[model samples]
Target chain A: MAPLGDNTNIAEEVMVAEAEKRPVSTIVIIIAMQTEALPLVAKFQLTEDLDSVFPKGVPWVRYHGLYKDLHINIIWPGKDGVLGVDSVGTISASLVTYASIQALQPDLIINAGTAGGFKAKGASIGDVFLACNVAFHDRRIPIPVFDQYGICAKQTFPTPNLLKEVQLKVGKLSTGDSLDMSPHDEAAIIANDATVKDMEGAAVAYVADLLSVPAIFIKAVTDIVDGDKPTAEEFLQNLVAVTAALDQSVTQIVDFISGKSISEL
Target chain B: MAPLGDNTNIAEEVMVAEAEKRPVSTIVIIIAMQTEALPLVAKFQLTEDLDSVFPKGVPWVRYHGLYKDLHINIIWPGKDGVLGVDSVGTISASLVTYASIQALQPDLIINAGTAGGFKAKGASIGDVFLACNVAFHDRRIPIPVFDQYGICAKQTFPTPNLLKEVQLKVGKLSTGDSLDMSPHDEAAIIANDATVKDMEGAAVAYVADLLSVPAIFIKAVTDIVDGDKPTAEEFLQNLVAVTAALDQSVTQIVDFISGKSISEL
Candidate 1:
């Protein structure tokens, strides 16, 4: 948490035991997976939290920065690489990398990533895979698909209470083993399911479940099911849709956090 | 979904699905993220589900195969660098990410990354930061802490249920903003946290709440809090620690997925 600098400091949020302040009721943490943390930070109005830094929190740190005028410290878990691809799947490896995120007493958490698309009838590149539910496409038992569920892991995922509570258009998500580039096949896979194929959805879902935070996972289909790679690589504009959606979601989440959505706290 | 060649197809657990013997519940897909997927083909296992060709998820693709398997997949909503250092503060993006993951139906999840330790505590160049709970670290209001608990996004993270049910051991975790990698500060941050630092845990926690999956998130203290230049390049062991932890986490996660221990899985 310290390596991220004062910008990621949570010391400001800490209530001095002597202060005798109210116990924070609704604390939320936001994680932006994959790409760098610049774009998201660009949209926020930040105010440093000066009191929290010291022997307890990060050194050379300020209080904490604000995002969208909301309160919560942020971290960029960093671009991922293989921890042990030989033993664990990419998704599983990702889940264990941050084994202590649960330490923070957060009522809610979220994971966001860029995903490839399966050529679904209505699905196209840059579409947000607003996962209604996520599953391992690669996992399969020795059983046939027509009979029973495949060999899926037992890990849990983040809850989507806010996902449903917030009114927005969403597409289901499907997990896949490989990056889908073929329009025809991706289309077929999307045709089979009502979502997009991403690398981290299942992993994030698994972690959130363990933490018991009401999670709301979402992804922006970066490219078409077979959108030419390198052809569209430069754009990476796929995140734009996700950002747009996030911009919209903030209003609702903030409303809920402030107790304005359900009942004024 | 189609890139997986049909050559390798193995099942771990078996059950009678549709009256036919099949894997109980598991699916494994193999792909290359940043480092290219071909060389690793030899590392492929029999318990894999190939797409079509032998060693074929997407036959003849020269992908970098980036991620080496970090334990947690903290998907950031930042696409094309729209965010900044503390961009992960917003729960909206994180919540959206959580919703995408929930669709997968995992049982547990977590986030891990590199963080800067700002203090001169035990934060070592290659230690880790383990957090018991995440504090917004930034929400400072004029009202008393108790009165404004609603305004703050500080909270606690839920434990991984499977780990509890199965009894898995957990290490340390911490939170902060500074990437304390100075030989002294690095040791301090590492001594204090676990051995890592990075942003995104809080968001991951927030999303995990929605999914109901327990999780753990920690970052390898990559650099010192007071130093600049990303210490990632300066320290070798610090880099190693993250990868090692990531590897350790991969095995654990796989065991969780396989319903077996690291050795058994």
Candidate 2:
């Protein structure tokens, strides 16, 4: 009885020690566009790594610093050296997210970006959203069993505390590589019950799931998908303002996440 | 003058030594389906790593062995543990390809799979093609410069010698996560001048280019995209026969690559 009591006491002490450590310490934010990254970089005061933490020749950029008690790293797939365009698609997002996870091994990943909102789903321009679920809108495999695999729907890490703390809209987010939705994409998106759409959310979610990393998506509305205006025109028109909204929401989120456990969130 | 001559001789000896090492010794073959991977695995006499070379909980399978003088690894994203369905889309393809490349640094990547061939481009059932160019048909980002980036068109490594040695067809290949082509995808495919379409070729190409590894694509026609028959029905009917053709073609190609360098090909 004495030895058993000592072992029990030792186990309790180990449990107490584990509980004392902060569950969420390091955070990595994956942003696809430089325009979307700049505001957050300024707000977080993240310094660019001039030596480049990523592989050579690729235009992937990393900015790092500490926010409060949390270590923060924001990574973006930089502009194409030849085409001079921001690398904004699922392919680049997946590659960068995979590389970031492999390199940083952060406790949490936050995919913050701009997306097109659906007015039918009660979304408006410049509204920030915490995505509850994410899936691809364009991968349409028509085979029997493979049809569902094409969608690859995934749920983001639950943050009920964060949701209650912040007054942000919550919705299902659909992802596709296309900026403009085709008829097929519309049908798929409707089936997905998605309120917001972006190019990289589901891809990032897929990579995160593959690596067993918990991820949260915060998307700001840049355009109304079902609206009358052209997608490209509306996106460009609202990018700057929407990015500001996203930056503010992300800042609040990171502040809340600091010194808190994943279970607490 | 004597010292200069000796230095020249040493330089020539170093060049000869470099040339003597087999340049194309390690090869990775990425197949998306089990039915497509079985034949190649059997032909190469590869043993399945039941212990699993991939990360735990992922269904990615690796079959590896020595084929003649080359080290060949055939990787397939296996069936979903819960859903019991083959993981078959760009998301799974990209993640598995990235993981495979990181784990096994290979000299070449050969994406071998079944594809929907276009009758308008003179593709017939069971026709094997070595893709000359690879691009995406469904990633339709409509922004000004991003319109081109969405397609992400890339050229495959040239194999003029192999082309001369083999009698397989050669054409442009377009990739999308969708098995069924949308109208927008069709338009993009036409613009890509694609003769064949699959779900993973361009994704594999993207990762390969990011890692600076040379890649080649081998596709066998399983269905005619523009034909009168239904895609699913036709694809099901031809899958077995097409796999045979793909196996034969891949075997011949591997045999050809056994003793040659990338420069020689």
Candidate 3:
């Protein structure tokens, strides 16, 4: 039997090649935070759809425009109107991704976000990673058989060519709604062999997989999980600089994705 | 301001009254487990829609039939094809609920399942509860203002008349995807004043709220979260008995809901 990674790569390659015969044209970039999204929105010259493409009363926002040969749409679950806080978590991310796919019918999805990295896994603040896989660390359904389902570990579209072309770090990304790691979460992350942790990536991956849309993840580290600093303090202090790094990485990705097919990536 | 209970009741009454002038004819029950759903399906004499009502290639199942004057439908995220495990988590719950609402167009949603209950909150195994509100305990955003958004607390439709008619415990429900509680999760649950904890209720509520569909949660305690017993062992030991209890309570509630308006409940 082939290794899990080998099986995953073979499956992804076949799925992507068979699913698309033309070069990827329309792309949806699902970003959870407004601060993390602003730089990319500006860089891509995306215009906000003030006409409200989503359902009425939802705080979801979509910015779209043509970038080179690709039609790029950046969708963010906008701030809660009453609380004035950006909606960031698995629920909001999955909903927005589902809605965006249904509404835009994009060829591919790119989940870009800021995350906490593990220094032990060779990560430092402001380093950008292209996730090879994504899984949930907090969804710990401990029942037999169901425990694996809780992880929901999914391989992102295998990008062997992209890995060769881009000089970005690649790692398994673990996602939970929490910003801070608990003992249980830490164990689960270690089990998943995750180097990066974020709130939205796996949820987006779930939606993308469900809808049979090829997806990739680009995560920028805002804080080091194993470092001796409070998560909230470190995250807030480094958010600006990390987001810029995320912007640069995502820009390069989008540039690479402009006229390439999924197989090429 | 009036007390939260009073305000919630008043607001719920107004929303229920305004949303539907006639009695509710269609109802969707979102249950996560087949063990919990089979009894209700039998009680309602629902026929499995083998023709596949949902999108193709998905493991979601829907059973529907008429119970008295009410069109009853039960939706569950079916077992994973590969692992043969029930897909139980916030992600699956949210997606299935969203899709069910879109497809069924039900007048109301009832999230019925087993949950771990706090003994400190006056709960015992097999004791059924009507969730007054639902929130997430594991989604710790930690950022100011956004922390509240992470909790995602939303009030369930107030069933004052039903509470008066039926003898059942009422409490707030805290949700996370984990079957076992982490210390951080326990803290968040306490902060939410939650007496019941489940994997799917808050997620169902989120989707229902987004779709403007009234949702009610009926939870039966399968394990004591704060008790001396291990959660998995206790949950497995109590599941069969508690599911029976859940079936009975849900039958009574459905009977009461039959031929009645949302405001009447």
Report lDDT (CA) for all predictions: 0.37, 0.85, 0.87
Q: Point to the candidate with the largest DockQ.
A: 3
TM-score of chain B of each: 0.47, 0.91, 0.93
lDDT string, candidate 1, A1-265, tens digits: 0112122235532422212233224333334342323344444444334453221211111212444334554333432121211111232223322232433444444445555554544556545545666654432222123112221222223324545576544666655433422333244344445456654455555445433334455565566554455423422555665555554454445454443221111
- In terms of lDDT, model 1 sits at 0.37
If candidate 3 were superposed on the true structure by all CA atoms, what would the RMSD be?
A: 4.3
Model 1, span B54-149: residue lDDT tens: 111101121111122312222322211111212222222243234334333333444544555543445555454444554322111122232122
Residue B141 displacement in candidate 2 (angstroms): 1.4
Q: Give me candidate 3's TM-score against the actual structure.
A: 0.92
Q: How does model 2 score on DockQ? A: 0.37
**Local error of candidate 1 at residue B92 (angstroms):** 28
lDDT by residue for model 3 over A125-241, one digit each (tens)?
999999998999998877888888889898888888778877799999999999989899999999999999999999998877766788899999999999999999999999999
Cα lDDT tens digits for candidate 2, A96-195: 8888888887778899999999999999999999999999989887787678777878778899989999879999999999999999999999999999
lDDT of 3: 0.87
Compute the interface RMSD for candidate 1.
26.1
Ranking by DockQ: 3, 2, 1
